[model samples]
Target chain A: MTVKLYIDSIHDALQEEMRRDDGVFVVGEDVGVRGGVFRVTQGLIEEFGEARVIDAPLAESAIVGVAIGAAAYGLKPVAEIQFADFILPAVNQLISEAAKMRYRSNNDWSCPLVVRAPYGGGVHGALYHSQSLEALFHHVPGLKIVMPATAADAKGLLLSAIRDPDPVLYFEHKALYRWIKDEVPEGEYTVPIGKARCVLEGDDITVITYGLMVHHATEAARELEKEGISTELIDLRTVAPLDSEAILAAVRKTGKVLIVHEDNKTGGVGAEVSAIIAEKALFDLDAPISRLCGPDIPAMPFNPPQERFYMLNSEKIAQAMRQLAAF
Target chain B: MMNAQSLEVPAMIAKRHDKLGLTDHDVVKMYHFMLKTRGLDDRMWLLNRAGKVPFVVSCKGQEAAQIGAAFALNPVRDYVLPYYRDLGVVLVFGQTAKDVMLSAFAKQEDPNSGGRQMPGHFGSREHHIVTGSSPVSTQIPHAVGIALAARMKGHNLVAYTSFGEGSSNQGDFHEAANFAGVHRLPVVFFCENNKYAISVPLRKELACEHVSDRAVGYGFPGVTVDGNDPLAVYAAMKEAVARALDGQGPSLVEAMMDRMNPHSSDDDDRTYRSKDELEEVKSHDPILSFRDYLLDCGVLTEASEKALREEVTVEINVATTYAEKAPYPHPEQALRYVFAE
Candidate 1:
C-alpha cells in the first residue's frame, strides 16, 4: 500500500483502467495537454498519446454526447466536465441519451460511459464552481451516482464505475483532493458501488453521509464520543442506488439517525434516505431522523465567513448530533 | 426561375444522373422507395385520424432528400442518426415496412422501441441507425461522437446525421459542428431543410440566408441543394460522403425542401401558412417530380408504375395487419430494460 492523495488515486485508477482495456479513452476540455485543471489527468497524454487523451473544444454537451455515442459504438469513453456546475449543459445528453439508451433500445445497446466532475462547496469556489449536483441527478434511473470520501474508495469506486455496464456520474470533492490522503492498494481493487462502508462503529446514534461531509461527520462523531455518545458513521459510496439495507441495519443498531451532506436539505439524498428509514424502520427509531445540510440558498457565497456559514462543518454536525443524542 | 417540370427532368437529366454513377434501374429503385415512404406516411395519417395510432409525423415532401442522401451512404458500413422525419432514410437503410408499421402500432415486435417510444423515434441497431429522442438536434453530437470513435478505431466509415433547417439553430448543432471540425471526424451533417420548424417559417428561424452558411465557422464545406430534386440531393450527399471517407472532416449538406403536410397530426399549418404558399410548395413535390423524371428517362412506364404501386400497397397492407394484431407489451414488462439484464 502506498500513501497517496485523493486526486492521485483517481489518476492511478484512470491509468490502470486505460492500460487494462483498449476501449477506455479520455476526452474533455484541456484534458490532453493541460492534464485537466486540477491535474488529476496529468501525464495521461504522454502515456496514451493524443488519440486516447483527447482535448475537446470547450463544449460540455458535445463532450458528453460524443462519449455516449462512443460508448454505444463499443468504446468506453471517460468524459470529464471540468466543473460539476458545468454539467447542466450536458444533462440532456446524460439524462435523455446515455441514461435511457439501454431501456429505449430494449437492451440492444448500452452506454458504458463514466462522467467525472469535481463537485462540492469548499475552497471558496462560490456560485458556479461550487455546487453539489448529486441530488438533481439522483432521481435518474439508469445512471449511478458515486462520491467517495477517502483516497482508497476513490480509486476502487472509480474503477468499478468505469467497469459498470451503465453510465456513472463520479463526483470527486475538490476540497478533499489534496487535503485527504490514505493508503491505496498498488493493484486493482473495487469498492462495490451500492454498498456503504462503516467508517465508525458505535451504539448510540447513526450518521449517514457521503463525500467530504463524511470526514466532517467523523470529526463530529469523535467529538460526540468524548461526551459519552457513541456514533455509527456509514459512508454511502453510491448515492443513486442507496444501500437501504446498510442504512436500515445501521439505524436498527443505533435507533437515532442523522443524515449529513453538503448539498441543500430539500430534495437532497438525505430526503430520500430519511424517507426510506421513515417508511421501513420507523418503529426501530428512538428519535426522529434529522438532516443537517446546506441552506436553501442558490449557491455558496464568495466570502469565507458566508461560505463557512453555508457549508456543513463539524461544529454544526456536532450540534445537531448533540440535540439528537439528548433527545 | 426554373419550372418544376424542367427542374425535375431536363433534356440532359439522364446523362447527368449517369455521370453521378446512377443507372436507370437505380433511379427507378429510388423512386420506388420514395413512393413506399409516401404511402406509409399517407396510411399513418389515415390511421391516426381513424384512432388506430396515437401520433403521426409525416415526411411527405422530404422523401427525395431523405432517400437521396441515404442512397449515397454505404448502409452496411456507415452509421445514420436520422431525425424523426426520416421514413425514407430508414426504409433505404434496411428498416422493413413491417418494422415501420410495428412502430406505428407500438407493438411488442417493434424493432425501434418494442412499443415504448412514439412512432417517429426511428432506431434499429441491426441497420446501424442510432436511436433518437424527441429533442431537436441532440442526434447531431451523437453522430459526431460515432464518427470520432470510427476514426479513433481506424475504421473507414462515416456517420450521417439529418435534421430540420431550424434544428441548425440549436446549440447541439454548433457544438457538434465545432467538435467534428476540430477533430476532422468522418461525419456528414445533412440538413433536410423543409423550411419550417413546427409552424415557424425559415425566415424567422435563421438570420442567415442558408443553414449551411454556419458550417464555414466550423472550418468545413457547406452546400445547399434543391431538396425537391432527388438527383440534386444525391449529388450533394455523394460529395459529403466522399469527403468524409477521404478524411477531409465533416461537411454540412443542407437540402432545401418544403414541408407539404402539417407538422404532425396535432399541428395545423393552415394557421401559419397560406393556401397559395402551400400549393406552390406542393407543386414541387419530390415524389411526383422524381416520378416524372423517371418517366421522361424511359426508366418507368405507366404500366410499371401501376405494378409498383400495387406492390407497395400489398406490402403496406400485410405489415399493417401484422402489427395491428400484434400484442402490446405485457403490463409487468413495463419495468423491464430499465437496467441491463
Candidate 2:
C-alpha cells in the first residue's frame, strides 16, 4: 500500500483500467493534450494515444451522448464533465438514453459508461463551478451514483464503476481532491459498489454520510471521543443503491442517528436515509434522526464568508452530534 | 420478380430509371415496399379510431426517401438510427409486417421494446438498426458514436440517422454534426424534410433555405434531392453510403418531402394546415409519383399493380389478426430487465 493524493488515485485507476481493457477509453473537454483543467487525466494522452484519450469539443451533451452510443456498440467509455454544474446539458442523454438502454432494449443492449464530474464547494468555485448534484440523479432509477471521500475508495470504486454493466455517475468532491490522502492498495482491486464503509466505530450516536462530509464527520467523531461521546461514522460509497443494511445496523447499535451532507436540505440523500431508518428501524431509535446540511439556497456563494457558512465543516457536525446525543 | 409479358414504356421514363442503375425487378420491389408501408399506416389509423391502438404517427408521403436510403446501405453491416416517423425506413431495413402490427398492438412479441415503447420506435439487433427514443435528434449523436466505435474497431461500416426538418434546429443535431465532422466518422445524417413539425411550419423552424446546407458548416458535403423521385433519392443516398464506406467522413442528405397526414391520430391537422396547402402536398405524394414512374418505365402494369395491392392487403390482414390475438406481458414480468440478470 502507498499513500497518495485523492486525485492521484483516480488518475492511477484510469491508467490501470485503460491498460487492462482496450475497450475502456476516456473522452472529455481538455482530457487529452490539456490533461484536463484539474489535471486528473494528465499524461493519459501521451500513454494511450489520441484515439483512446480523446479531447472532445466543449459540448457536454455530445460528449455523453457519444459515450452512450460507444458503450452500446461495445466500448466502455469514461466521459468527464468539467464541473458538476455543467452536467445539466447532458442529463437528457444520461437519463433518457444511457440509463434506459438496458431496460428499453429488454437486455439486448447495455451501456457500461461512467460520467465523472468534480463537485462540492470550497476552492472558491462559486455557483457555476461548485454544486452537489447527487440528489438530482438519486431519484433516477436506472443510474448508480457514487461519491468517494477517500483515496482508497476513489480508486477501488472507479475501477468497479468502469467494469459495471450500467451507467454510473461518479462525483469526486473537488475540495477533497488534494486535501485527503490515504494508503491505497496497489494492483487491481475493486471496492464493491452499493456498499458502505464504517470509517470509525462507536456506540453513542451513528452518523451516516458520504463524499466530503465523511471527512467532516470523522473529524467530529474524533473530537467527540475526547468528551466521552461515542459516534459511529459510516461512509456511504454508493448513494443510489443505498446500503440500507449497513445504515440500519449502525442505527440499531447506536440507537441515535445524524445524517450530514453538503447538498441542500430538501430532497437530499439525508431525507432518504432518514426515511429508511424511520420506516424499518423506528423502534430502535432513542432520539429522532438529526440532519446537518447546506442551507436551501440557490448555490454556494463566491464570497469567502458566505461560502464557508454554506459548507458543512467539522465544527458544525460536532455541534449536531452533541445536540443529537443530548436529546 | 417480373412477369413474362414484355410491357412497353415511354423512352423518357425508361432512360431516367436506367440511369439510376435500378433494374425492372428492383423498381417493382421498391414499389412493393412503399405500398406495404402505406397500407400498414392506413390500418394503424383505423385501429386508433376503433380504440384498438393507443397512438398513430403516419409516414404517408415519405416512403420514397425512406426506402431509397435503406436500399443504399448494407442492412447486415451498417446501423440505422431512425426517428419516430420512420415506418417506411424500418420496413425496408428488415422489420416484418408482423413486427409493425405487434408494436401497434403493444404485444409481448414486439421486438423493439417488448410492448414497452410506443409504436414507430424502431429497433432490431439482428438487422443492425439501433433503437430510438421520442426526443427529436438525440439519435444523431448516438449514430456518430456507433460510427466512431466502428472506426475504432477497424470495421468498414457506416451509421445512418434520420430526423425531421424541424429537428435539424436542435442542439443535438449540430453537436453531433460537429463531432462527426471533426472525427470524420463514417456516418450519414439523413433529414426527411417533411416541411412541418407537428403544428410548426418549416418557415418557422429555420431561416435557411435547405436543411442540408447546414452540413457545410460541419465541413462536409450537403445535398438536397427531390424526395418525390425515388430514383433521385436513391442516387443521392448511394453516393453518401459509398463516401462513408470509403472513410471520407460524413454527409448530410436532405430529402425534400411533405407530411400528407396529420402529425398523429390524435391531432387535427386542419387546425394548422390549409385545405389548399394539403392539396398541394398530396398532389406530389411520393408513393403515387413513384408508381407513375414505374408504370411509365414498363416495370409495373395494371394487372401487376392490382396483384401487388392484393398481396399487401392479405399480408397486413394476417399480421393484424396475429398481433391482435397476441397476449400482453405477464404482470409479474414488469420488473424484469431493469437490471442485468
List DockQ, one per candidate, in order: 0.80, 0.78
Best by DockQ: 1
Q: Write the per-residue lDDT of candidate 2 for residues B1-341, one digit (tens) a residue.
A: 23323234325354465667877888898889999999999999999999999998999889888888887878888999999888888888899999999999988999998988889888888878787888889989999999988888888898999999989998999999999999999999999999999999988998989998899999999999998778888899999989999889999999998898999999999999999999999888888878887776667888999999999999999999999999988877778877677
Candidate 1: tens digits of C-alpha lDDT, residues B42-117: 9999999999999999999999998899999988999999999999999999998899999999989999998889
List residue ranges in candidate 2 displaced over 4 A. Answer: B1-12
What TM-score does structure 2 among the candidates reach? 0.97
Predictions: Cα RMSD each: 2.4, 2.6
Report clash pairs, candidate 2: none
TM-score of chain A of 1: 0.99
DockQ of 2: 0.78
| lDDT tens digits by residue: candidate 1, A67-124 | 9989888899999999999999999999999999888877777889999999988788
